[model samples]
Target: MKILLLITPSEDIVEKFRLSLKDEYIVLTAYSFEQGSDLIRPDQINLIAIDITISESDKIKSWFARHRNIQDIMWLGIVSSDISEEELGKYSSIFHEIICTPISRNRLKIAIKNIQERLDILSENKHLKLLSIAYTEKERDTESVIRLSPGPLEKAVPLFRTFTASLDLDKLIDLFLDAVTDVVGVSRISFLLYNKEDDVYRVKASRGIHPDISSRIYLTPDSGMILWLSTRGRILRRDKVEGDVVSKGILIRAFREMEVLQSVVGIPIMYEGKLLCILNLDRKITSEPYSSMELEKLFILSNYFGKAIQDIYKYNIICNQKEYTQKILERMGTGVITVNEKEEIIIFNPKAEEILKEKAADIKGRPVEVLPEPITRLIRETIRDKKAYNKHEVISEEDNLYVEVDTYGLYDISGLLIGGVILLEDISAREELSREKKKGENLQLLNELVGRMAHELRNPLVAVRTFTQLMKDRYSDPEFQDFFFSTVTGEVEKLNSLIEKLIAFAHPIEYKFDIVDLGEVLDNSLESILRAVKTSNIQLIKNYTPGIFKIRADNKQIYKAFSYILQNSFNAMQSGGTLTMNVESVLKDATIKISVKDTGRGIPPEDFKKVFDPFYTTPEKGIGLGLPLSQKIIEEHGGKVSVSSVFNHGTTLTILLPIAAQTEEEV
Candidate 1:
């Protein structure tokens, strides 16, 4: 189909060849051997026709040999009858066929046909090579997808639920191994769960390999491939390990036992950013090397397996917590309900259903507003306030349930409002408890009142007895009588002081509630305490921030609460250690918190929760009423008292109070 013409200096012969082949072929004509060689392009020239009658025939032959080195070309040498057979023999290797001086058109067509078939075969071979490369790439991609796809156990919801629901260590490990084997498509699997307590990695579970091999394969920081992978966090291909002479012994033994002659892949399972275990898969049963694609798939699959393991562990923790919470809720005398953001009831415990006279099945999917009016209002208020609200002894007319409702807002990880939780405590039995508590409080108050009363009465009585004895001794002496009158007046003044203290404790408080600043109150209280206890050894450390921490409370009551806590701290640090007072504004919760910490003898852990109860004290001479009274005052102001203490180390008492309406100065 393609032609290259070698034209000699004889213009007549060049014209004859071009005219004859011009219609049947694409003709390229060159006047000299040098010119023809320059025109030849292997990709374009499929056939060459030379006119050898010219004087440069020998030079033409040499050019053909040189051009043949460039590419395989079908050369058709045209020679005269005078050309010898020996000369033709030299051109035979380079030319496919020879045409004599009287060249026929049919002979030329036959030669062209033979060259066309050769070109077609070459083209077909090139195309087949390209297709082979494409198929290799496709197989690699598919192997990667299979290796990386989430395994049955990885995405298995029921497996996750079961794993999370139990704390049995052995079961958790077994389930993990099963998932890895199923997903990785490798029957030969082994796990070594690291035990920090023992500083060793124990072979917990394995599949495919002999039990004896797994039993002997215990790993430590110094042991085997697992230890290396843990420290490196890189996948170790079997070929790379086997090729290293230093690692040959270990790799050889492992390969021999697993019957994996070709290759293996090892991946580390990381949890909480720490290497928890390693998973290794042997070569396929067909003894084929795991290509680069398979290795990449293993990497992706291992990441998912790691995540599943972490989820299973977290599931178990939440399961335990849920169980503990259920037990506590069932035994509690209070009714509890949890609702989601849509206000639909998510949880209605047995106690809640019984107290409301409704079944859980009927109320679970219902809105929270479906409950009694008081309960609905409580929940709405709590969500609006974004804080806990307590209403004591609120009688619900619908159910005739005398319950104390405590509602609090629930928040998610990002501090976004999720829903609310309500605890309904039945106060029918609590009323009796309250009555008994009140009786005990009154009895204790009475005892203190009686002691003060006796102290006051004794002073006057003593004075009277002394005056009588003086009168009896002096008989009718005017000077002794005057002295007795002066002494009796002084004693009467002492009796008045005792009577005033008794009256102050017994009388009702006539205090008014207003927006008071915590910083100012604390400063004043501290100044008063420092002035009252003017001992050179007692140091008062004030760590108060000068900001208006506004709270709705009785100023006098708050002052009294601060005084009691400060007094206790001062007493505890008799030898004088640091008494830290911390005050700050918590803007996120819209609350003001004040902390009074003492580096003194701390309360015992067992007594931490009981410290607020009336008449519970650790001090030798304490009346045991300070903490209880402080708690009551804060509670009245819509706040909470929390104490964290460590025995013999220190104690911290934190008071969380709602911030009142902000003034222009505060803003």
Candidate 2:
């Protein structure tokens, strides 16, 4: 239930509203703006209806505009039909409804319902935004707790455990400071390593100290406390010394200036009976002195720390070697798996996980029996023979999957059998490529048949032309002459169709667009071309990236373009050659590059640029449309085709295409 306030000085409005006003609303009436201002209660009033004919209506509008609390209430204006456009526009923004001279109760109810619905929607939106912000803040808080809770020493211990031979000195010092600070309960610590040339122990690192203190403090042979410690290489505590010695020494004076009030302890780190560095700890702004137990622990820690420091080079060497080996295993393109004598998996690298489509954690320590029959048999054979074995295995678990697996018995340095190792190289695409090459051979045979077919049709074509000419010359009759001309035209058209059929074998028809993987298209094209060149003594190598290679393109047209380029390479390498195809995405350039390099009789430099021109051919028997058609297809996909060659060396052709824009998940 809500209240409505009505204001007007007109008798007619009062009379009309008195009769038509709804009973559900708690209505209040004011005859003047001053009366209405005093009567209005923002919390109680949900709607306001003001008659513009009243002399005080402008003053009422001004108050409503200025008071934000009142502005939220739905407003209605009672105006004459002749209200000017400018005034109407001004009031439209402020008022939810307008009533003409004759007020209708139904119209007022509808307006109120509409405004309430809009307000409800706005409230819901605000609520949702608040919830989103709250969730985001909760996530940030959780991350902050995890990141900042651990102490420096706690974090460094793991790094120490993983060490092989060497250690980072700076990191070691920081960790030592943290350990000492936690154990000794000191506010400040500094490590001053002996600098022989300077004849002083200079500050190498410090914790919880002002920049000025770190920069200025140093100990030389003449310094009081340092000189006293030099002779014995023992721990020194300020409280144990005579009061005068404690207060008057240069070290004490420096510590006082830095606001270290209670006490100080110095422990020297020695290696092979030679002084290395001094660890200085200070009790600052507190009256606590170093305890006997703290001093005992400090000596033991210093001894351990000294030995660790001496072996740092060894630790670093071990760490580096481990990292190097791990990086190699992770980055290898071949799948590597190792099994112990019990035939249980011991090592599974990333490539192994990818090829097998299983996680290392799930497979490691699992028996070889869990593997497929072919792979299991191969592993068993190698283990039994105590020798190396190699085999090509076709896995039809997925479409077009072929792999070459090499298995060998693993041995210890003593030449004793310990385990077995399996290496897998995917050759599915290569196998498919062999099939495509066979298809190319068939296409070549078809081409030869077409040529013979053209020769066979030529004799009949000639006879038809000669016979038609004779008929046209012998018969002047209009109907007979027309029939002869038509027959000759139809025969000529048939010959033209035959020539078109020949060209069709070389260039395919236009294609529709599709979302396709460019890498797959390249593999398919090479497979087709490989069959024709297999006996030509040519070798094909393909290097393609393993991730998203999708692009919006006409798959058939792109396949045709790739085929033409591959065929051209085959033609150039008639005797024998090697073709390398590499496909990789360049994110910074926002493009993908497909490079086809051939070791063949290379194109001359002068004709390199002209190779893509229409009908441009260097070889006497060349059709010249291959490169031009490839260029057209690439350009149509918002890409470019380029070539580089050195005479008698080789030629490399590159095609760059824009990567298709995709949504986050698709990318």
Candidate 3:
């Protein structure tokens, strides 16, 4: 098949060209003349379709000028309709067969077919000339023998047996090269093998030349020589001027290197219409050009090489896949161990070594019994039963290691048992965390008990208060009634206050919003708490800038919130310690902070997180509802409450409230 040099940036254009010219041409694509130059074989590229916009027109012209021997290269110029009329007209005058944009596959088909017919005629004439020359040579040397012979074709069955039976590709390629030169009686032979990695053909083996010289002969996929060899897929004669590929601009880099080695013939080793490698031969020892018979002998031998190359490719692919699978096993997180049907350990991954605390070198290829007893038993069971066992526990209480093990029966493609595999994962931390989480759930259940306690405790208190009120009202003795109302009523009031606080801590509150000055609110709370509690022995320090900050809140609720914090400080300082109260605006005055610091019996470090938990308290200090309730109210008003303490040193309780907008309303 002929190669059509299809130079276009658009993949769609290349596809359309290939589909349109599929019967006659193999499309070789390049984005520009710079890249397309390498594929311009004198024999293969008989047609070139160039997309010539204004940007590429200059390059196309210069490129055409560089290759002076393009007398037969039919140019199919493609131009977009978007170009200005002046440039279109100018380019039209310079090029023929210039198809305008919006062209269809059928239109392209007609144009390419017209050129193909001309190329066909030209090719036929060249072939006829070659035939005529061969006929003349044959007539002169009628008594001479076809000089070239394949050494193994001299023993044809052996060549087939070796090529079909051998597994090593390198040796097979060498065998093919050897057979090619065996009876040719030539000193120069070069084998250029394709390397998929770099997408080039380099000399793999050679004879009758310096090893250094042979190494320099590299043929890129785009090399004009390679294009001809790949497309023609037959023996090529360097002396055949009509089909000559190694011209000045044709082969480019490959042409120069091939020239250095004095190579005069190229044989393409092809199979299934794919070019696998190339062989270059020097002129015969008599310096005579190779006849068709000689070329024919080498061409037949290339088939065996092609078959060998195919087998080698399959082998490499299998090796790469195994390496890829091994890579996945090495990097995965789960521990994996596989053992053969004979119970010999194999394929111990890194994670398996880590879990078992043994080196792979020490354990692999040993008996499965070398592993822990549980792992060995599981693998044995999985193999014997031909089934999988998932998530069976393996615990080592003495070492505090807990693992979940899963065992599976390994099988070959034929479903026959080949081995067994085990998967392991550490679950010790996860199990411990689950137990701790259950304890927290039990604590949450305790909150439910408080609701029932409130109901039982409040019923008797209500009865006593109601009875005491009725008796006091009807007593008729002034002294007794007055004493009954004061003494008994006071104790009942304390009981009622405790019940209300308990209800408040467990439920949300309703607030009456008002503008309250934070400093004054703290002052009122301090005065009230000091009067209520026996804090006469404690030193009090108050430092605040009055009326500096205000908050939008319920006034009474704000007062109560401050009283709770103040009460905790006073309660902690009963033994004559200093109590400091301070109010300030912080965070660039975005919020107001009220803090009470007590230098007596500070909270221990361990109880810091429990400070705001409801009902947590000591007999000597206020109930835990004081801080938790204050936090609830502060958060409802878009604020935060926090506590910082040093063990046996002091505790500072702080409340932060957002600064509300100032108005005419005052506290």
Candidate 4:
């Protein structure tokens, strides 16, 4: 039971105090403030209660010389209902509690009990010498311990005060180790806490021991030292417990493990019935064995630490939960904002700050007006109408941003609207991807157009060179001379209009449909390739359906396509090669199949897939545009191209065109 003092002239108030505190405290009474000052012992009288009107704080301070211990005492003030506000406020700072009279017995008992707990903690701190604020500021190193205060209690005042200052587990261990070093003047120390998951005690923090050495040291449940600590439930010394040598069962190994950790003493801190931590210590700097008083102080400190560990873990759980939530928000890719019914921003994630170009710190907790007009409109609309909008695209012309927004109203368990949530995704990036795709398509088209122009110009140049080569042998033949001259002139005219062909390619080509003979078109294609060839041993074979091969089609385009195909077939050979043309109408399929086969160098296996890609080429091949241009022309006339090849053997290129309406003209 604690001693209590009541300083009030009111007999009725004093009677109420006695009834409330009679069972728990030694009730002492004084009639006035002057009389109470005489009873105040500063250290012994830790609790005091008085009528608010009678106590003069200045007079009491002057009489006591403002003792440090006196300030720590818990004071309770009792004031009447009619007391002025100024006086009530004045005493409020001086008292831990200000209960208005006439106070109920239960209320007085509760107030006094709370103050009693405070006073008990204050008394314990004083006993540990936690009186002055300067305790935490003092150096806790070895030298400070050497320049020591004589009494153990006097040296402990600052160290014990430092103990209660932190709730952080790691920092608290550091302080505890430092305090032990300061008070006990030990050369080395290590603090270990029990890990529930591992069922072992591991060093959480340490001093004096090598940094790498202590963390690796631990005590398992079955370890000799842990077993001893669990059974003994007290500090372990190197010499003996109950006057037996530590060289016996368990103690021998326990002492050995402690020696490895640079410790000769181990103090086990237990809470309730469980061991919470162990404080391992080496010898003192003075090389003297610990006194009984020093051991007693350590036990007191260890008891306090066991309780502190529980509180620290509780604090960490709450802090971790909040930190985990913050990390999730920081990592999200979408802008997220939550608001209250008053239209104030409560939560603004990092993505919101980036997308809106606004700082979260500046805009959070502010009204929705701080956001862009479109975003604010959505928030207001959702809150006012209590509806949800999904995938709402907002093209902000003035801000020049394309954004997709989603908004929903938030509600309570009772179905009343509490606030609203807004989600934003910037879809402008998708627009950029779409543009890049279009640009790639346009680039491919340009490649084909340029490739077509190169193919046209190269064909005429090859013809002029072939005719000139034939002149070397047939210059004296009249028939060959006339045909050569006419062909050469026609080839030169086509070369002169190369620039015009380019202009035609720059725009779109309009194919003119006409009634034409398909057999004549194949003959003209074979003749063009024969004129371009410099070889004489080349053989041509043709297979055509026995009928009038007439169709409504673009005659020039079909001729140009066949001419390039035959040219490719002949160009595959250097001197002697056989070129076969197979043209047939499949009446069942309603199509024309033209197969161009060459007994020349075939395309490699790897190059087969890229045969029709514009500008794809091989060594000594003509500009690589012939086949792609031919394929494009056939496809424009509703046809498809196919290829098959055998390396070094031969290559076959086939064209399939939708057979158009038949005409009366036959070839």
Q: Tell me the alpha-carbon RMSD of every candidate.
A: 25.1, 35.4, 16.5, 20.3
Best by TM-score: 3
State the C-alpha lDDT per candidate: 0.67, 0.70, 0.74, 0.77
Evaluated against the true structure, the overall lDDT of model 2 is 0.70
TM-score, cand. 3 vs. native: 0.42
In candidate 1, what are the lDDT values of residues 276-389, reduced to their tens digit? 766667655534455553454455445555666677567778998999989987777779998887788888988998788888899998888889888887777767777677
TM-score each candidate. Answer: 0.36, 0.31, 0.42, 0.39
lDDT of 4 by residue, 410-507 (tens): 99999999999999898888867877988998898678757765776788889889989989899999999999988999888767644543343345
**Residue 395 displacement in candidate 2 (angstroms):** 6.8
Q: Which stretches of candidate 4 lie over 4 Å from their true place?
A: 1-172, 194-200, 204-216, 228-234, 237-240, 243-253, 262-264, 270-276, 283-296, 303-327, 339-347, 377-420, 427-667
Question: After TM-score superposition, what is the CA distance of residue 425 in candidate 4 from its true location, in Å?
Answer: 3.0
| Candidate 2 structure quality by residue, lDDT tens digits, 528-618 | 8786454558888878743457777898878878988998888888788899998777789888888999998888877777787543545
**Candidate closer to the true structure by TM-score (higher is better), 3 or 4:** 3
Clashes of each: 2, 16, 0, 1
RMSD of 4: 20.3
lDDT of prediction 4 = 0.77
